[model samples]
Target: MHDKTAAPENQHLSHRTAWLRAAVLGANDGLISTASLVVGVISAGGDAVLAGIAGVVGGAMSMAAGEYVSVSSQADTEKADIELERQHLANNPEYEVEELAQIYRERGLTQELSHQVAEQLMAHDALAAHTRDELGITDQLQARPTLAALSSFFAFLFGAVWPLLAAWLNVTFLFPHPLITIAVGTAIMLILLGGLAAKMGGASVTHGAIRVCLWGLLAMLATALTGRLFALVVG
Candidate 1:
């Protein structure tokens, strides 16, 4: 039996804007930084597990704090803009209407029809219309500091845990070299994380995986080289 009243399956991905950026950035930073730190420590004959743990904790907290402050600043700007719009509407209602109508007219609507549509929309919800069409603020795209902070915090923890776990496994199993295990494991995880993020964002999986893994490997290599140089100098 065919169901004619079935809801539409198509959906836009823009709604993920609030948290997707924070999550992807935090996860990538955490994975690469923690892996690099651990590899460096291992190269320098230091404790890989300890360095991994410290890196994860410090990195996660820093990511959360940074995301919160940055997003909060954006939120403040949005609020100020919205408030300014409110003031303009209160002080000059007619001017605001014509302004909105002009925006519609620029969008291809006829002059008379634009004015009518603007008036009706303003009569219903002037602030919403102006905020969305004029100022480009919408509910889905609005800044939310708390959500961003939490997303980064958890995403960082998720990404950092892999390298830390690899380090621990190497120590526990007496692996020949912690560097090999940690670097390989971190690279694999970064590739997976990149592909997953890309899938969620409707991007190319192969491109994302290769891009993240390459950068992560480069970071770990550079850090490990610095550590080797430091070890040689100190010894």
Candidate 2:
């Protein structure tokens, strides 16, 4: 028996897939980019405080703008596709129903049962049935430009805090050059962030943590080398 009901809120766990991807990518960008900026600027004998501030603020804004534009474009495309689907259903509904049933059949339903399910579901909500079965789209999968933008912006801001604060504290209070401590802090934070995100997404925690940390190490190394080149040039 079909449940004949929707949970309203948790109807689709697939909805979180895009959000998780965007957020994890955004926050990792924020943390790594800002941290790299901090390390580079300080290594080049510049003001760490000012550099950290610039990285956090500038990187956050950039993340927000990029996410908004990219996700908005995707949303626009999906909207257009949905509109086209709606037209097809209106103009050639019988064909659409067959298409829906065929989709179910391809998913392992018997031909007769597939038709019955399609017919029943179409009777309940024709457009929804076609969209879900034929087009593989749903309300849960619809993109939200505003939500993507905000999540990216805030996630980046949150991730940037680790390296920025570590470098600043070491410089002002503990050490003359904070590169070692900054590296240590950044490595730990990246591991934690990746592990937590992977855990939430039911992915391998070790793999995620190692991947992010390795990339982070590379980014920082490249930026630090750039700082060295700049310092030599200035000299």
Candidate 3:
């Protein structure tokens, strides 16, 4: 009797690279940008809630649009490569087979085995085998523009909402030093977001947290100075 137990599937992070990148970038930018906007407005003695609201909305839309356009471009390139490969396979079947076999040879397979494997694979599905092996295109890593755009939009909105909420709470309770509260809250969120991103990417959580915090601090500082200068110039 043959054992029919299923093999365990490996969970590789490469498959998540496309969407993960968009989500992380969107969230990080939204948090820092919105927080910076609120900080700058507060530093200029303006209404924090109003600035936070505007920044959150505008930032989320911008992130979504940017992600969609960029990912669409990547998808286009992939499509073009696939079409070109199809043409090559149609034009010269023998050369394409040799090319695929050469790829296998370079990857450590013996010449005899490589050619055999290539021939068998081509017989089964020539385009798929070539696209995957020669062109490095796989269904797992295909770029989906709509998915990326939605991920970015939601992530940005989620990140921006935190700072907005923090500002609103500060104002509602009449905090004497609202800037401190907003800044601290934003920094905490940034650290947490960084850790979460790093965890998903299989990297050091502490390093990611520290790195994002530093950048967030610098962005807020720059914006605060700009607001101060603007206030000084106008008022």
Candidate 4:
């Protein structure tokens, strides 16, 4: 007999995993992409304010749309799986029970114990039991499309603001060399963002920082090249 008191603890862990994954992914993408965009535009001699605003707005919309589509698909798949499980339970419950029993048996339970466990579980909540134990579906990991979209959009907006601030301050004539100031500020911010993401994800901070910085550099280089080409063509 499982201790009912332990359910909350398990649920909390699952929830943490889901939210943490989404938050980290959102922040990381926001930092990397927004920084890259601003850096690229600045390298091309674009107005800092315009570059920053464009980066923030574009990144937010992209993140929201991408997250919505991805999470919606995930939710759809989960729904389909649950529906299939429901059908199987309705059409061939005996077989489903046997399947559940076999799963328990594989986990070291004796055949008799497995059968009893499956029976008790099915009696209490058949769908929940099969969805969890058999299908490995949990309420915590269930994707909420709307929540995912909102979270991603907001998180990206927040992360993108730092770069925008750098650009805005550059435009205010506060910095001696606005471009250099923006570049340096963006580089430091990217390093910080990467380190934060790595710490959260239990990854190497150095590697993450290097990866982000390299991408930003690449974006700047590409944009600068494009700008020079255009200037040449116009001249």
TM-score of each: 0.91, 0.86, 0.89, 0.84
Query: Positional deviation of 92 in candidate 4, in angstroms?
Result: 2.2
lDDT agreement of model 3 with the native: 0.88
Question: Which one wins by lDDT: 1 or 2?
Answer: 1
Off-target runs (Cα >4 Å) in candidate 2 are 1-21
TM-score (C-alpha) between model 1 and the true structure: 0.91
In order, what lDDT does every prediction score?
0.89, 0.84, 0.88, 0.77
Q: Summarize candidate 3's per-residue lDDT along 1-235 as a digit string, tens digits.
A: 7556864565676556646755776788889999899989988889989989988888888888988899899999999999999999999999998999999999999999999999999999999998899989898778898887888889999889987888898889988887788789989999998988887887899999999999998988998998899899998
- Per-residue CA lDDT of candidate 2, range 1-235, in tens? 6566745653443445657766776788888998898889877988877889888998998888987899789888877877898899889989987988888898999999999998899899987776676667788777788887788889999889888898779877978659888888888989988887776666799999999999998999999999989999996
Worst 10 residues of 2 by lDDT: 6-15
Model 3 per-residue lDDT at 58:
85
Best candidate according to lDDT: 1
Q: Ten residues in a row with the worst lDDT in model 3?
A: 6-15
**Candidate 4 or 2, higher lDDT:** 2
